[model samples]
Target: MFDTTTTPDSFARVFTKGRLSIGLITPLEAYPESPFPTLKDHQQAAKQAEDASFSSLWIRDVPFYDPNFGDAAQMLDPFVYAGYLAAVTERITLGTTGIVLPLREPVAVAKQALSVDQLTDGRFVLGLSTGDRPVEYPAFNIDFEDRAARYREAIEVIRTLSENHFPKAETMRFGTFSGTLDMHPKPIHGRLPIMAVGRSGQPIEWLAQNVDAWVWAVDESAAIREILSALQTSALDGRPPAYGYSTFFDLDPNPDAPYQRFYNVVRIGRKALIERLLHHRDLGVQHVALNLKPSRRSAQSVIAEMGTHVLPALEAA
Candidate 1:
């Protein structure tokens, strides 16, 4: 049911092939290493990000707060938050940095995904993953070792149920299905564009063949180059899936703050941040989501700067 024609879905329009767009990760506040957001004025921040014309507002899928895990993500259920944000904001796409697929049933996930898609008027993008947190797997009573295989199974189920009306299939995780039952509230374009984070336990080729896009963490441009090179070699048919990368940014108070790397994050100023994003674009990144929790300034100001300076520059390029 997916539209393979020139008319792209809302998600595909913003995350266009061969172009780069910037999006903000939510709980939009200066929490640094802490999991909690001030949350008091975040509704306003969400409005601001949309006004600033960010391509999307992203939320994380953190089911629980593992004290040892340190960061609790946005501290909200992603689907719930997406539904809320979809109502609160206009025009901006609602996305998940990822939803943990192996933890939930495929039909349930499909229903929720399509619900959000309709709620947002086709502005939803599904980013699914196998989930890396060991603490979360056991908490859900799922075997950590089987997650990869289950993840692959769930992908098939989601795709099948989304595209076919009363699909017939046999699978280990989703069980057998006949043409007797069909998924309801079909996606706006008949299917939602599926993106995956990391490997999700499948080979690069498998991911390349199935998913519309792929996301990963990058500390440097070299990693992006390697991924782009690999994508060129293993892409489905001749259509290479879009590649995206995410990083934490601590925007310095100075407008001309220099770039410095810390682990997977960068503590940099707007000028430097713009330079980095353009470089990422040059490296074939279709999209990048920035987490502002590490910033010293208010999330409002960071959002404004990115909206005014960063996103515009990238869009123009």
Candidate 2:
């Protein structure tokens, strides 16, 4: 059901126009402290996202199911789930809310992501995270201390795997095949866009140097501005556009509270939501993914409500 009309770079256009294209962080809308969501939830939510006209969907990579950590993503693997979403939903971009490259084999990631890009007509945005989750790295037998270094190397490996038949990779994956092996079925436009999730393993400086776009964590406007300002000032790489994500409690149509929250406790109306959207645009956040989780509202109702209220504010802005 993925659309062939829009390419990965087209998603980038949403940034340049000072426009917003909302997406969801999977488990599709669950609590911050929830372990996992049902696969049925992911399936239904994918359809809802497409039906609601969300520009994209986001998923995260969690290698281990630490009880203390609380959130385990959606138990099924991220790319596998993305493929399922792609098959069922048309036009919405499917992406990793983030993949922790430090613990993963880059070549494997490259193969999986490329397959997804090709099969889904290239609607993939890379929310790549370096993975500071201490428990995950130990479980994977990866060094948490040097994740930043590994992250850079892994990115090189993934990029090479996608762009060339025989790529120069220096990491562990490169050891598997020293000679050339062509990575078949390149993405629709030959590649997917990679956006770094916060300043994961490396400094914000290195992230700006490498990734295509930036997504500041926690939907913090100030954090987004700080990083954006640093990127603008630093000479690391190209100027990058930035975005953020948050979760909503799904307030009623009419006003109750008159303000918003870091956890998205909004005490207001559609006008307040619109005003916030405009403020984010003014603050220079290009996209915001709302985690409709831990809410009193169910996924379907929240998606519908957000579409009616949130999507228009984004589109009109």
Best by TM-score: 1
Q: How well does each candidate superpose onto the true structure, as a TM-score?
A: 0.95, 0.87
Candidate 2 achieves a global lDDT of 0.68
Top candidate by lDDT: 1
Residue pairs with backbone atoms closer than 3 Å in model 1 (clashes): none
Alpha carbon lDDT at 208, candidate 2: 56
Q: After aligning candidate 1 to the native by TM-score, how far in Å is the CA of 34 from where it should be?
A: 2.6
Error of 1 at 21 (Å): 0.5
What's the C-alpha lDDT at position 169 in model 1? 96
Write one digit per residue (lDDT tens) for candidate 1, span 1-317: 12357434577655676688878887788887576776777778889988998888888888888777677887888999898898788888888878999898888888889999889988888889887688888888999999989988998898888889888999976778888998878888667878887788888777767787788776478888887788768876677678887788788878797998888677888888788778877878888888887888888888888888887887786
- Worst lDDT run of 10 residues, candidate 1, spans 1-10
- How big is the positional error of residue 88 in model 2, measured in Å on the Cα after superposition? 0.3
Across 1-317, the per-residue lDDT of candidate 2 in tens digits comes to 01234334546543443666677777776453456666556677778878887777888787778887666667778888778877887778778868988878887888888888877777777678876478777777877887878878888877777777765455653345454676777767766677777577577566656776667555557776776687667534345445555454454556444555544444345667677777877777777766655555567777887777778767776
Candidate 1 to native Cα RMSD, angstroms = 1.7
